[model samples]
Target: MAQSTRRRFLLAGAAAAGALVVGWGALPPRQRLNTAVPLALDGGAVALNGWVALAADNTVTVVVPRAEMGQGVHTALPMLVAEELDMPLARVRIAAAPPDKIYANIAAIRDALPFHPDDTGNTQAFARWTLAKVARELGISLTGGSTSVKDAWLPMREAGAAARGMLVAAAARAWGVAPDGIRTADGELFHDASGRRATYGSFAAAAASENPGDAILKEPHAFRLIGRAVPRRDARTRVDGTARFGIDARPEGMVYAALRMAPALGATIAGTNAAGVLRLPGVLSVIDISNAFSWRLAGHDGAPAGVAVVARTFWQAKTAAEAHAIRWDAGPHAELSSDGIHDDLRAALDGTEHHVYFAQGDVADAQAHGRTIDAEYSAPFLAHAAMEPVNCTAQVADGKVRLWLSTQAPSIAIGIAAAVAGVDREQVELHEHLLGGGFGRRLEGDMVAQAVAIARECRGLPVQMIWTREQDLRHDAYRPAAVARLAATLDAAGTIKSWDFIGAGGALTDHFLRRNLGLPGAGPDKTTVEGAYDMQYAIPHQRIAHAAVASAVPLGNWRSVGHSFNAFFKESFIDEVAHAAGKDPVAFRRAMLLGHPRHVAVLDAAVRAAGTPPAGRAHGVALHHSFGAIVAQVAEVSVHDGAIRVHRVVCAIDCGLAVNPGHVAQQMESAVAFGLTAALEGAITVAGGAVQQSNFGDYPVLRMGQVPHVDTVIVLSGEPPEGVGEPGVPPVAPAVANAVFRLTGQRLRSLPLRLA
Candidate 1:
């Protein structure tokens, strides 16, 4: 009997080993690093792997895949190549790359998996696996979520280093010395032992034939351009008004188009009185808008059905469009209102089937373990309100589709344009342009798809469709409104023993899957519940859960997404807990963040930067980590005439390393303004299922006078750089709100902190 059991065990072990081997083989290999190869050269210039090009004049052009949406990605990404290639940053130029899998954004997509930052169980593992499979198979290229730098960090460096090595090898072979004897700097290679020197451009042709075997990247101490405040490559063009945004593009024979989308998602045009306007002016024809909802296929953003009026000029199109009155079907969502959605979300707080995104220790007995504190917080829906608005130029003819636009995801836009124009994906040509601003709005390609659909009806004529500012604001896929019910238990000694959090809102991922993938997205969404649940506060017993309630309102990522509101929710509650514990807010937080050195470092730095605020002025501090970055902020504020005014903010960030200290500082200031707008007056209301805000007059951002003086301190480290754009956005609001609570004695839990 013993021998039989032993034989069974041995067989089971062998079977497990065989399965492991098969699974490893089935897994997709990592993206190829040496995918770069020299392309055909012309005019004594050598092109390498669609990234680097060396001209005989010693000029370097780096092909950048990410979009330049005022985030300095175009300037920052090429800096990576310049640093590794030992070339001057001023000499490195940028060129847009073609839509190809080799340049896909593999990091951003995988980072969006439906798993909390603290999640480590099978659910998290499965989410990662699914995300990897999708990213590897689809090759999604996006430039949002503050991922452009992190995504291109290694690839850009490797491209430059490898190219430089090839050039050095060519020089070494000519000098009759080892490759190590050849040193390169500022586009010139020298062999000290042989007393031979030549510009990289002089050996461009021979270098293309030489092999780039392996490259040794420079150490942190060797970095010259990095960590320095380098000037933006396009600074001259922007100030000179030569920067071409989507609104500036003009294709040959392209006529103008103006459109008014249905007021709400699912609504349709019942009829249009275009005959009267068609004969009035330069108006040509009215085109009905309809396309496959396979791209950005969610809510109101999925190629919304509308009517486009094409004319000779934009003014003519707008005038003619205004003259025509269209009747809308006003679908089932016509009865939906902001108040109604809020009520539904609040009702979901009492739901029984909560999708527990994170759990630790004994949360079921949290109330019994300590004194309980409970609070409810809410935030309103928001619009993107980008300065450039939404515009697309499209022409579909001869089984080909062409578009010119500023989009965060050009590859996605290409696929969407192709699908709508009834052409093969390979037949699509995209002219990527710069955006005035994105704020997550330009990430969708629905506007491009809509333009293509309009052009499809035309007689192969190029058409440029521009949404009126009112239309852009009203039709935007605004950020979802949400509410959270939080409960924390503190022991007799004032230490937090347990925490329970519940949030309800429209799920971005679920909405995306339902519309785009045609699947039942059943589970917790990381975006909706991220900042609320994934906090670093030390608690023995904790459970964070989110309940999803569907709404007709359109939703997309708004800057920090969940962190925007979750910070206000969690950080405000911490202030309340601190007061309840009879402890100072900063000291109370410092106690909870004992074991977290990185968090403590930023918190201490912010406090020191703040120095000593005025005796009567109230100071509030909040620390949060998001997108692989940690941030702490101290807001000094005052109230006058019932208005809360933030005078100054001391900010500290540890985003691994400051790739560009100037850019990092600028981002901090930008985020402060962006976040302050939300804290002061960033809200979108729905009435009868239509967005009530039409333009900036109704949806205002922070003006120059209202902008607070932001003092930024970057925490230096040898660690690899993390996200920079969005991490600065999350902590600003909470820091301001906490200060307001101290001044007013009323815990303003909701956004747009109102005072009476």
Candidate 2:
């Protein structure tokens, strides 16, 4: 058995490496090259060596792997690295990591599966297998689906701890003292007994010389910095306007470009008359950006065909572009609308035979002998709708192109820019600027290629291509709309006997994976159907299936990915089952989760924090475990003046060890606000093949006035730390919906719940 296991392990490792090679090869050749030096020292005196660097003045620098779009990962992730390094919070700085496979998220790996994480008997083995498959498929390690923090929880902490160990070893070697005798605090190593002390800066050179070996990490009980609350490292800079976002980047001799794409998806620019627009004030040039190569070569249909108006300033280009007369070949999707898409999905669900994703026991027999309940739910398409719109600035000079932008996929960006400019990837320099927000839209590198194309046409002059708020809204690759049908059976004692879920939506995984593998036909997209089919409840029988339907609108990942819509469908249906069984929502969930103490603890904490009656606020509780964390949220809501006002929210999270209590709390608060906004008024509808909502005024985000008083409670389970960024998102929608149900006695089947 042992020999067989070893052989299997070796085979798996070999396969993983092979997949990595194929995935990398599938990307544009430009992305495979590297240019930036492994080590860099900034004017802030901060050092960046690979993924981490420390300042001569004692500040620590950490390279973040994911984009920050209100999830507060910029603050939360640095906190994790700093805690493990035992550094003071004020001395830590953050930088976005370059694209590489080392940063690919493991949660997204599991998400690609047709099964749930808990359903596997050996989660570790399953994870390894899934990761190998992902490496073979995605090619580059990119961040999406809120998996950044969770995926990096271990590797990042170990990197920090290893660095700290090296510093301690260097200090011990210098002081001629036992390693145990040396006490390290902030950035200094000291020996009080011998009166010997040294700052990390003094030993950094020697420490850098010594290779970090396999050092034993500190146990959770011995950690002083991991669980404590510390203020955000970037908070002051962000508040003081010192933080430089993508829009803030300006190069010498930089000109601006504004764009207008065909309103309908899959449309192409046939021709454009730039004479009248070129005569406008500040109009420098007009360039057509059609045929810009796709950065995501995997599963991409074609280039992001569009036209660019170059001007001296953003407003000038915008005015000129608006005045320019452009003709478009509105492709097959010109007649598509939201209602039409909904009908298509409904037909697919009803008529098409879906791929069997998961099956356990005989669901037919269980349903045959028990009381059955059936329900259908739907969610509209959604936009990432980041505060800062989509934009990229590129300068191509002397056969070299430099890009400064807030992009989730820098590696892909370099490759796309290189392809467009007809240069080697190594010749392109990517200055990854801080993103105002990047749920997943930035993951697509079309804008980077567009900017590069414009810059190439302008004799290597720097060109800043800015997408106006209107364009950003109208042209985003939206989260696909979905329809779910759930059926559950209960026994005589009211226990759930069987569960079945069927989903129909556009396939995100199939598009990317099939394109990379050179597969011809459409395959089952597991992401659209996995969440509802893979319920965590201990039902005796369960079956899940999914059918992928073609859609004209471009689809991509959103904040919780499948869970954003699936959680609502599954949890809300579970609540409906509880109502059918004549039990309270909290009680029903607790009864179902008899053996899971971690999930139970969070649910209990959330309910208790919500308080009892006399407050006149009804409470609704939702518990979901995703991206390695188990989170429970209790929402208190009341209806007044024909409006549903969420008054208070209590959240309890168990994300293994609390790397930074303050950051965790902040993330939970941010999640509540973000999720609440989506639940209240976040939707992107299509009419006449064009996006209807243009900006915040039409597609409203949650404002400060609408935010509830949030109470965050962290549950420290001596387990390994999970994810902090996205686990908080899934529970918020269901919790709020449940609370609304309590207040109005009306169950909202869809999102953006209307009160009157």
Candidate 3:
């Protein structure tokens, strides 16, 4: 059977099974009919399924449900699948799987839950409830939150083991030997006593018939590929310029499109001279794309209202768009500026009543007795700035649509395209392409809709809608800027008595509800409140609250999400507390993290790895926990020429078990570059509702000459691997900032620290 048909069969079977279990005579006849239906997978298989097909030529294809955007999921995830299947890594070929609920990420569900491990109910019961609700709402469980590897850690491995089990069973049946007697190694099943052996490819078809067995997964001790350094499977293709990104995809008779969105958010086209633009060479059509905000709330200025230019080539469309004379009616936020936004957020925080996400003991009472220290820190708005600018290719014909794009949320992309094109979800197909980099921008489906619109306008001819670098940077959903106020009380012994954190920022929770979770009007988003509430300190009294301030600028998840700002806030405050107490910064953090061994382990490892710096070198340490992983970084710095020069950085991460040491190291290196860019020169400032910086000239990335030699230490706790991509980001900023503070005796509260 074809892949699509097989996938549908599996989904239908899984849905029926899930419905029987969920509805089980508990509801009335009418209620049972109205209950939410579960999404089914193809091939009549359920419960976290994947397949490995070995062709006669020894080419092994492993299907994955996650998106690959430089996170190395394409490499790391397949390593698990291949190892469990007992196949050589060199023979494995990776394919992105179809969208299905079976692949929905369980970690995002856990993130949405209100119940903590210390909550009243049984932890397992809470987990079950959280996951079921997530499955019902998300429709398709998939990527986001750097949970791809952790979520797939078990299921993908199990699928491989089960496939191996089936192959062994088939081999045993063919050789007329006991299944237990069959031994496998290097893709070959052998029975030394009987002198019978067969390659997996020879038995793949026969293996498809046998019932898959539930073999226990290999322990860490038995792992051959899990902990070892393995080169990325797609590295050769990527480096050789053979891997196709969204911009590289070109269907037959495909045309290109360039769009000029309204300079002001929520503005509409008052008038346009389409008649003049239609005469331009290579210009096929000028489309007035509608602004839809049903999925997300309209910002202060509103949706990205605009016009699109479709042409024979991207440059043609771009040229035509530039030449087109269009007038825009600026919306309500015409006068909005970055300084005005700062004032508005500060005003919001001044409110007496705030939404409290987490509180322990009485912060007000503790604040009254001891000496108190207070400070405010702020971070500027940030853009995703992915290497490959936003682009999506679509072929829409007779109510059938297909999308080729690099998207983190393929299920949502398909659903949005289907809805916009007025077609059944089945008719809308999504082909996952290699993303140059996502950061989080690819999660939005607007580009998918734009491509579909251009395709529909071209009479079913495929259209590859591409955004210019300027358009991509200006029209991006930005990382929200934030302002935080931290107040703490210290006793005479220099111990923290009370901690109160109040922050004001754009609504991350609101965005998550609209974009990913598909929930509307979910109050007081928890993402903005997470890092503050979940601080890994042994404080006697603590309270964390957040207030949301509406802004004209678009805001969404960046690399580390809220933790990026919160780590800067929390860690900087901790350093402040240490300074007030005249204690060593590392010792101060170590004292507060008395109960959390993993946090201490990373801190200890980073410090010891850093060792004693030379006389001129100053050391700074920071520890942060995010995505279920704890990381600590130590930076050694020397100041010269009014610049903070970092000589070396020592990073230690304890993410349970290191799946692939090489991949982990690469992620750390990438994370350092990502975070350093943000720390040194990353900022998206708006003046009069327009992004001020364009391209790398103003918004700079870290250059090779400025980057210090980084040393990484992965501490193995034998715990389950949590996350590697984003956890590495949170610590670097604070570590570097703290090092700067040590060198100059100046407390730098804000990011992109400037030395004067």
Counted clashes in each candidate structure = 0, 0, 11
Ranking by lDDT: 1, 3, 2
Q: Where does the lowest 10-residue lDDT sum fall in candidate 3?
A: 28-37
Instruction: Name the weakest run of 10 consecutive residues (lDDT summed) in model 2.
Output: 1-10
Highest TM-score, which number? 1
Better of 1 and 3 by lDDT: 1
CA lDDT, every model vs. true structure: 0.81, 0.75, 0.77
TM-scores, each model vs. reference: 0.94, 0.89, 0.91
- Per-residue alpha-carbon lDDT of candidate 2 for residues 586-653, written as tens digits (9 for 90 to 100): 88999888878888888898888778734667787888877668888888888777687888888999
- Report RMSD (Å) for each prediction in the order shown: 5.2, 5.1, 7.2
Give the clashing residue pairs of candidate 1, or none: none
Residue 61, candidate 1: alpha-carbon lDDT? 83
Q: Candidate 3: where is the Cα deviation over 4 Å?
A: 1-49, 114-125, 292-303, 515-518
Instruction: Name the better of 1 and 3 by TM-score.
Output: 1
lDDT of 1 by residue, 85-133 (tens): 8888877778787766767887788786544454467755654665565
Ranking by TM-score: 1, 3, 2
Scored against the true structure, residue 656 in model 1 reaches a CA lDDT of 85
